[model samples]
Every structure is written in structure tokens, then in C-alpha cells.
Target: MASFSEREQAFENKFKHDAELRFKIIMRRNKLVGLWAAGLLGHTGDKAEEYAKSAVESDFEKPGHDDVIAKLMADFQAAKQEMSEHRLLKQMEEMLDEAQRQITAE
Candidate 1:
């Protein structure tokens, strides 16, 4: 029984609320993920925070907001990629060390 303007107002309120909630979720999830990733990568607290910020900034939204969300997701992926690279480098170092030890033993 709501008029068109009333329906529009209701949607605006819901949209605002949903956006705020989504941002909070993004920030919290990004912080947790970044913390774990940073620990594995040996990043300092400041660097970890920066990484988390980028991650939170980069996330997907609903179809109407895909442009903004897509950009943010790209940023999140980049941070994750950086962390992945760090882990890979550490693993490579361990492998190289083992190889060197085996060669010396022979």
C-alpha cells in the first residue's frame, strides 16, 4: 500500500544499511585474513594493516554496484597475490637449502 515515493524511500534506507553492513564485514574479514597472511609472510603490524586496508577496499558487491566492488576486489587480489609470492619465496628458500645440504653430503 506504499506509494511509489514511499517505496523508493524504503529502498534507499535498505540500500544504505546494506552498504554499511557490507563494509563492516569486509573490514573485519580482511583484517583477519591479512593478519594470518602477514604472520606467514613476516610482515610488520603497520604493513599488515596496510594490506588489510587494501583487502577491505577490494571486494565484490551486488550487480548494481559491480563496478565499485570489482575494483575493490582487484585490490584485494593484489594484496593476496603479494602474500602468496612471499610464501612461495620462503618455500623456495627452504627447498634450495635442502638441495644444498644434500649436495654437500654427497
Candidate 2:
């Protein structure tokens, strides 16, 4: 019984750590996408980092990337920047991969 309890606790700890890592990856991915978008929109330096932070915050509106997509689409249109939805989605996917690698390395 004690051994079983210890195993269960270990599993719980691992689950929590994995969940935190996943969240960090998502946030990093968002920031990466934001930095890319900022470059396309002619923002640089501190402005670009601020835009990246906004991208991370945009995810809070809903579960999944819908909110981030909508925000990016609106921003692009407003800034008169030409960006296809397909391209944006692809960038996000690439960033996600990079983020996972970065988090795993850490």
C-alpha cells in the first residue's frame, strides 16, 4: 500500500511538470509568432517585444488558437499588411515546433 501510494505521487508530480512545460511551450510559440508578425508589420526592437507580449495575452481570450488568429488577422488588416491565413498558420506551427525543442532542451 505504501509503495502504491508513492508511485501515485510520482505520477502526479510528473503530470504536473508536463502540464507546466506544455503551457510554457505554448506561450513561447505565441511570442515567436508575434515577433514574426511584428517584423512583417514594420515594428522593431521594443515595439516588437510589446507586440509579442500582446500575442501571448491574446491567447487568454479562449482555449486554443482562435483568439490569436483573430487578433492577428485584425491587426494585419488594420496595418495594411498582406498576410495569408495559411502563412500565419504555418508560422505558428513552425514556432510551436521550435518552442517544444527549446523547452525540452531547458
Candidate 3:
């Protein structure tokens, strides 16, 4: 049987792992979506990387990915790029899986 301290340590370890995983997943997802949006907006090379970082930063504007989506949608519209919200949502879902796989592999 584990003592109280041992059980507490195990719980702390699990919490830390979970938090780190969540952070990695969100960051990876943001990078993937940023790259996709950059491509749509004709950004390449360093410009695309900068845009990707912006995407990651946008996520901090609010809870969840609402801010990111809003920013991308507005940018698309402003750039006269035609992209349905549904398509963006789909890409987000796909990117999430890719992000999970990427973090798992790292």
C-alpha cells in the first residue's frame, strides 16, 4: 500500500504530465493551423513562420480556440480568400490529431 505522501506525489506527477500534454497539443495545433492559414494568405518562408507564431499568440486572447478562428476568418475575408467556416473547422480537427501524434512522437 502506498503512503499518503506517495499517493500525493503520484497525483502531482499525473497532473503535471497532463498539463504539459495539453500545452504541447495546443501549441502544435496552432502551428499547424498557422501554416495552413499562411499558405492561404500567400505567406512563405520566414513570413509564414511569423504568421504561425501569431496564430499561437492569438490563442491566448480568450478561452479555447475562438480567438484563433475569429482571427483566421477575418484575415481570410480581408484577403479575399474564400474559405468556409466548416472547412476551417474540419482542418482544425485534423490538425488536432496531427498535433497529438507529433507530440507523442517527440
Candidate 4:
């Protein structure tokens, strides 16, 4: 078995890496949200930032695209919306799984 300090250091490293990953995920999500809001609301740079903030703060009530995934893939060369949605969902799953692992490890 690893010594206490060794285990502690490993845990700290894992936590830090996970946090960095989460930060990147949030930043990426913010960009997508900003793009969507700006295009939809006719907002520009700073205004888009404001819209993004507001959207992030509130419950974003956009319609789910689950039903249209197959159509989107068939119609578009690149399944953009589907890929972004998948990334977002995967990040959420990873974060939740990481939390569970941490809880169990403790």
C-alpha cells in the first residue's frame, strides 16, 4: 500500500486535474451559450457577454433537441448541436462520477 503522504499527494493531484478539467468545461459551455444567445438575441460582444451571464444565472429554458438528433445528423454534414450536447452531457457525467469517486475515496 502507498504511504499516507504519497496517497495524499496523489489525491491532491487528481483533484487539481479534475478542477482544471471542470474549469475548461465551464469555459467551453460559456462560449457555446454566448454564441447561441448572441445570435438569437442580436447581441454584440459586450451585450453577448451580458446575455450569457444572465442565461448562466437563470434556468435556461431552451427546448431539448433529443428528438431531432437523428435528423440533425442526417441533414447536416457536421452534427454540431449533437456534438456540443454530447460534450456538455459528458462533462456533467464526468463531474458527477468524479464527485462520487472522491466521496468513496475519502
Candidate 5:
């Protein structure tokens, strides 16, 4: 049987792994959403990739996903794109599921 310390260590490792996975999923979701937004904003190829990177980085500015939403909304407005916040939120949710699937497949 495993000792207490071993069990504790296992739990800690699991927690760390879960946190890392969560971070990866969130970043992937941001990238996916960013790419979607980039396409809508007339960006393509390298520009779209760069925009996706910017969206991933925006998550670091805040604890939650608000920063990302704000950035995307501002960009949409600046580009004269018509995107509703509700639609954006729905897309985010869908992208999150896709992110999780991609990560788990790897």
C-alpha cells in the first residue's frame, strides 16, 4: 500500500497536471476564437496567426476571460464588423469544446 506521503504527492501531481491541462485548453480556445475573429476581420495567413497569438496573450492580462472578450470586441468594432457579444460568447464556448477535444486527442 502507498504511504500517506506518497498519496499526498500523487494528489499534488494530479493537481498540477490538471492545472497545466486547463491552461493549455484555455490557450487553445483563445487561439481558435482568435482565428475565427481574424477571418471575420479580413486577416489571413500570417496576420491571422499573429492575431491569434495576441488573443492568447490577452488572457494573461486578467484572471478570467473578460480580457479576451474585450480585446476581440474592440477589434471587431474597429474593423466595422458586426458581431454581437452573445454570439461571440457562444463561439467561445464552442471553441472551448474543440480545444478540449484537440488536447485530449494529443
Candidate 6:
């Protein structure tokens, strides 16, 4: 039997672990989406990877995912690519699932 303090500590550890995992999943999703967008914008190889990193960094600008979406929207518009916010959001959702699966598998 664990003491109360031990149980509390275990719970805290689990919470921290879950938070870290969630962050990783979100970042991975951002990278995946960035790659997808990069392809549409005519970036390839190292440029694509750099764009993906920028996508991950964009999330740090604000608390939620809006900053990322804004960046992507601006980029698409600048490149004269046709992309709707709805479609981009749907892509984010799909990428999120892929990110989770990838993280869990590793």
C-alpha cells in the first residue's frame, strides 16, 4: 500500500507526463501540416523541413493553434495557392491523429 504522499506524487507525475505527451503531439501535428503546406507552396527538401520547423515555432507565438493557422493562411495567400480555412482545419485534425499514432508507436 502506498502512502498518501506517494499516491499524490504518482498522480502529479502522470499529469506531467500527459502534458508533455500532448505538447509533443501538437508539435508533430504542426510539422506534418507544415510539410503538407510546403508541398503546395513549391518548397522541397531542406526548405520543406525549415517550413515545418517554422510551423512548430509559430505555436509558441500564442497559447492556442490560431497563430499557426494565421501563418499558413498568409503564406498560402502570398503564394497564390487556393486553400480554405475549413480545409486547413480539417487537415490539422487529420494530422493530429497521425501525430498521436506516430508518438505512441515510438
Tell me which of candidates 2 and 5 scores higher on lDDT. Answer: 5
Tens digits of lDDT, candidate 2, 8-105: 99999999999999999999999999999999999999999999999999999999998999999899999998888999999999999999999899
lDDT of 6 by residue, 42-71 (tens): 999999999999999999999999999999
1-106 per-residue lDDT for model 4 (tens digits): 5699899999999999888875555444544544453554567888877755654433333333232333223323242333345654554455446545554464
What is the alpha-carbon lDDT of model 4 when measured against the actual structure? 0.50
TM-score of every model versus the real structure:
0.42, 0.96, 0.94, 0.42, 0.97, 0.97
Candidate 6: stretches off by over 4 Å? none
| 1-106: candidate 5 lDDT, tens digit per residue | 4698899999999999999999999999999999999999999999999999999999999899999999999999998899999999999999999999999999
- Give the per-residue lDDT digits (tens) of candidate 3, residues 1-106: 4698899999999999999999999889999999999999999999999999999999999999999999999999999999998999999999999999999998
For model 1, how does the per-residue alpha-carbon lDDT over 44-105 read when each residue is reduced to its tens digit?
Answer: 77997776565445444444323333443454476564434445345434544554454446
lDDT of 3: 0.95
Stretches of candidate 2 exceeding 4 Å from the true structure: none
Those runs of model 4 whose alpha carbons end farther than 4 Å from true positions after fitting are: 59-106
How far in Å is the alpha carbon of 2 misplaced in model 5?
A: 6.4
True-structure RMSD for candidate 6: 1.2
Estimate every model's Cα lDDT from 0 to 1.
Answer: 0.53, 0.96, 0.95, 0.50, 0.98, 0.97
* Poorest 10 consecutive residues by lDDT, candidate 1: 60-69
The local lDDT score (0 to 100) that residue 67 gets in candidate 3 is 95
Q: Of the candidates numbered 2 and 3, which has the greater lDDT value?
A: 2
Clashes found in each candidate (C-alpha, N, C closer than 3 A): 3, 0, 0, 0, 0, 0
